[model samples]
Target: MSGIIGKKIGMTSIYGADGRNVACTVIEAGPCVVTQVKNEATDGYKAIQLSYDERKDKNTPKALKGHFAKAKTTPKKKVVEFRDFREEFEGQVKIGDKIMVGEVFKEAEFLDAIGTSKGKGFQGVVKRHGFAGVGEATHGQHNRLRAPGSIGACSFPSRVFKGIRMAGRTGGDRVKVINLQIMKIMPEKNLIVVSGSVPGAKNSYVILEK
Candidate 1:
């Protein structure tokens, strides 16, 4: 389904009608400009390329400046393509058309969100790979607290297995968390509050899909 490009604006809790606080992820959803409109007859698919977050023209490259010039719009910090739109989108828009959050997902709830997860750099076996670690706390054990115990048999295999879980980089990958209830949509401020936390750090780019 078609979606809007957005940024995760931290998290906060709000009270509901039931007098209960609902944890939510506040996002700055698009007031995106339709940079390019693609169709089956031309691009072999029906899709819209939306540009969000304005940037200074001087900061943008000359080639990209001309690209934005074609749309008759200012340079943008990010651009993304969305496909599988509703039938109402058929020939309804063109390049340089501004698509605000109000235009598309008005009064929407239960949306699917996608973003890159927070990066946990250089994690160890106990944290990253979830190893048992050392197995004991005492019994004259010196300092084998967080080690991967017994990787292989004595001499049968002689070499460690290929697919063994070990310490490495963690997180910073694309993640999609779905079925989150949209508690509020502040079109005036181009903000959306959804019930529950989403992947990624604050100010990171996120995609909200139907």
Candidate 2:
């Protein structure tokens, strides 16, 4: 599952062949540098680490400076590793090699995008868990439209059951959206447009797997 680390360049809409406006998320994929090529004998596993986005050298730590020095590349803002890389690229690439979006995903028909979802802070059950908050306002219930009703289990349990969907923190999680159709690929711009909304905010880094 070899992939590239990219930035989410927001979303856009393009007209389809059927004369309908199709929504898509534009991602600036690759132009990434291979920082590390791991092997089973040396690291106990196989993986390819890619570095993307430029960062100031002064902000980078001493240990990271040495790591990037081995790759002979400048400081990067983001680095992601793909485990059990695709067979096509196995033994073909090495550290310091530049991998473009078009090279690895040229024939890819679909993609899996991994990113951090937008944080929604604290939310109620209705918005967070799709709970149908107390029905009609009848039965002498006043101003309880968005209430979570009763959570107790009478005398048997007395205490509210755990794992019950309730009001709490929401979003800001690692989300993997699978089977996103590849709508377009702008190789020159190093961008890949995938159908549907991608996780994370604009300019956030994402991992594109095919």
Candidate 3:
């Protein structure tokens, strides 16, 4: 499906046509430049590589700088690839094609959002692994609260079972939520406000796919 790379510019509420306040995630979508185009014959697939957010030439890498040079555009901060584009969209989108959010997605009722989730660091089984911590709170349970309790049988396995639930790091992973409705599309400022909360913290890079 065709899509574009964008940034989560924060969130706000706007009134829908039904006169109800709808929570929306404001995103600074495209104005994304086509950095490369892949085909089955050449790259073994069909996709469009896009770049967003301009940066100083001195800060960009030599390979990326050359890639941008081929596209005839300045250096960009982020680059992403979209796969399986249609024939109509193929010729229209070439290297150096600047696809704004409005042009690519207009009146789009739904979208699929891909982003990195916020990190929560290391956590316990009660919070991280959802293990039912010691339930008793009044049976003389002084310090055993929020514990994983007995892990396994005494002598059957003689060792703690592998793949046992335990405390560990949480979040900071790639998450993709589908069917997010597009509330509004602003071409002038290259903004797309989507309904509901998207993954990741504010200002994080998000991919909005159709």
Clashing pairs in 1: none
Off by over 4 Å in 1: 154-156
Let me know the TM-score candidate 3 reaches against the reference structure.
Answer: 0.92
Tell me the tens digit of each residue's lDDT in model 1 across 4-27.
889999999998768899998999
**TM agreement with the true structure for every prediction:** 0.91, 0.94, 0.92
Q: Which candidate should be chosen as best, given TM-score against the real structure? A: 2
RMSD of each: 1.8, 1.5, 1.7
User: Which run of 10 residues does model 2 get worst, by summed lDDT?
Assistant: 102-111
**How many times do residue backbones clash in model 1?**
0
lDDT of 3 by residue, 93-210 (tens): 7798888887678664799999999999999888887777798778788877789888898878888989988888999999999999888888899999899999999989999898
Instruction: Write out the backbone clash pairs for model 3.
Output: none
Error of 1 at 8 (Å): 1.4
Error of 3 at 111 (Å): 0.6
Better of 2 and 3 by TM-score: 2
Say which candidate scores most in lDDT.
2
> Global CA lDDT of candidate 2, please?
0.91
